[model samples]
Target: MKNVIITGTSRGIGFEMVKLFSEAGHNVLALSRNSKPVSDLKLKNVTALEFDIANEPEVVNLSAYLQKAMKTVDVLINNAGFLVNKPFAEITAEEFKRSYGVNVFGVASLIKTALPFMKTDGHVVNISSMGGIQGSVKFPGLSAYSSSKGAVITLTELLAEEYKETGPSFNVLALGSVQTEMLEEAFPGFKAPLSATEMAEYILDFSLSGNKFYNGKILQVSSTTP
Candidate 1:
């Protein structure tokens, strides 16, 4: 029904999103550092692309590929992220850079490249964390990850305003901990209240129909109120 591009589709939320959108009959361009997972899906409407989001050359290649494959994009979901949990003192500079490289720069690059192919009134959803929301629950050892998500929220707001007179709408979804591999890694032994599939379903519906009512807003998706 629509042309959708989702980044970080190797697994977890991104993977579920690829299944959700493609099964709904949308043309889905799924990006991941490794294409094997999506490749195995064998979905008729899904195209798997292999590339690291943190790499500029790969992103450029994605842009060029999209230019040739799609005339217009209805949705762009920036779902790729890097997380490193450690005490603030133990957080290395390299770690921070790595986190920002994927969480921040990767997101910016995709938006920059995808906008040209986006149809008027298209939706751009940047996946963020609840920790990124001001006054939200704080956790130790999430310095880099939280900070990067915060930056994503800011960028979404600014981009939305910058493109107000134009076409596409930009929004950030600051989600609570979801039950996924990323959550397991970030908080070992702890169980998250929401599942990735649930989140993906909501995101698919919002991107396809509900996004027009909102622009430049950061909605915190969580069972527990922040």
Candidate 2:
């Protein structure tokens, strides 16, 4: 069984992933700001951690846990995201900072902390959004959120190149609209074609095998735009 670390595991896709990976007999470290949901499940081989990527102390705590509990890292899925839907003109500097803090900087921090424990066959999957793709459907209120995701795409490519001689392949996924609580919060009354479990299954499969075929690539996993 592989040792997998998945962020944003409180609900939605991340929550579903915890189940899928656990059922597949993988050791999963599920991290989220509120990890009670997964903690409540009390699944075998799954550790629910109350984590906030934007918090430095929490990142350090995660590093300690990884070093102490999990000797090696097999799969690290940066599924945590932060979105602020506000008009561009009305967007505040702090809002953009917070978005970037979680969506971009937080991801980089985790990778740095986890890289030491990752081997050549390890995989790092960073999750982005379809709206982050340039020239895709642009939404007015997501300037901060989408742009931050775009940054993650570029970051993934750079890391892959830097680690070419090393190990741990990195890839990013620009997902299309998935019917998640985040989507519901962003756009109420809008129904997405794919459910959380459906997307989770796809992601679980990819996180395990996608690295063999592609690295430093961005896969668009959405059939519809939100």
Candidate 3:
């Protein structure tokens, strides 16, 4: 019934969000570098758009396209990310920039363009990693990824405060490892405790309810049992 926009919809958690939201009867604007996954879904409620999230031009184009098609966006999930698991000493400046380009700058650009179309009481959920949290799970070589996510958390907090009078709420979710391509690439040989579908389900609930009372929160999501 509501309009939702999701980034990184080509696979993993973003893909699952597309499926979940579409099935829940929401109009979903699914953005990804590769549009095949969402195109293949052939859902009536889902519209797939292919674009480079890290590219400002592409993000701007997407925003214009959506503005023409949708009157208001009820939820915006900034889930697209890039991960580089290299030793801090080995990580080049270029590598760090690439990671931030996608994980941070891309997210900010999308938000800037989409804010105009966001509905009142809308929710903006920035997907971050648990590694970004001060005392959450830490990996050996995820410095770039963790730091980018940490920045996202800070950005979310500042936006929430800056837009307190505005109807839309901003919050960040620090997620534990989930079974996804990004996870496998970041932590080779390690098994994740949660599935993308599980995480998407939990996120869907929060996207609808979390804004009621909470904003600017860094929510750490993980399994209830070990």
Candidate 4:
């Protein structure tokens, strides 16, 4: 069984991934700002870590903790992210910085910390959004969020290329409006979004396939393909 590290596991998509992976017999390290409410099924091989991903000290401590734990991670899911749904004109500098801090910098920090423990066949999945792929007319308030996700997509591609010769695979999954708390916070009444469980299953399947053909590319999963 693979040992996986998943961020943003307090709720939504990350939580679902932790549950699914644990049930599939994978050792899961679930990290979030708050402690995850434990379920009976998660007690077997799931370890929940509570820390702020945006805090450099916390991330450093996490790295040291992992080193002491002596468990090599087979996969790292860069799933912790934040969104600010405000128009560009009204967006504050602090808001933009906060968004980037969590969405971009946090991922980079975690990857750096986890890279040493990753084996040759390891996988890294950066969860991006369809907004990162193309301009969104429907969500003009999400300029900051979209731009941050776009950066994640670019980083994912660059890392994939950098690791191409190194054997480990990296890819970006540009999800199309998955129904999660983040989505609800962004667009409260939005309909037709893919469910969290659906997206989790898709991610699990993709990661287990051992396919590197989609490396460095943004893979979009949506309810309605256009």
At residue 90, what lDDT does model 1 achieve? 100
Q: lDDT for model 1, on a 0 to 1 scale?
A: 0.90
Q: After superposition, how far is residue 53 of candidate 4 from its true place, in Å?
A: 1.4
lDDT of 3 by residue, 16-98 (tens): 99999988999999999999989998987999988788998998887668768997898999999999988899999999998
Cα lDDT of model 1 by residue, 1-226, tens digit: 8999999899999999999887888999999988999999799889998879899988888877887898789899999999999999999999999999999999999899999988668999999999898889888899999999999999999999999888699988998888899889887898877889999998888877756689999988888732
User: lDDT per residue, candidate 4, 1-226, as tens digits?
Assistant: 8888889988888888888998899888888887646443456789888878899999988878888874698888888889988889999999999999999999989998888888778888898887777654346787788889989999988988898877468888888877888878877887645788888888887876634566777887665521
Candidates sorted on lDDT, descending = 2, 1, 3, 4
Task: Compare the candidates by lDDT and give the number of the best one.
Answer: 2
- For candidate 3, the per-residue lDDT at 34 reads 98
Candidate 2 runs further than 4 Å off: none
Q: Which ten residues in a row have the lowest lDDT in candidate 3?
A: 217-226
After aligning candidate 1 to the native by TM-score, how far in Å is the CA of 69 from where it should be?
A: 0.9
Best by TM-score: 2
lDDT assessment of candidate 3:
0.88
TM-score of 3: 0.95
* Model 3 regions lying over 4 Å from their true place: 224-226
Clash totals in order = 0, 0, 0, 0
List per-prediction Cα lDDT, in the order shown. 0.90, 0.94, 0.88, 0.82
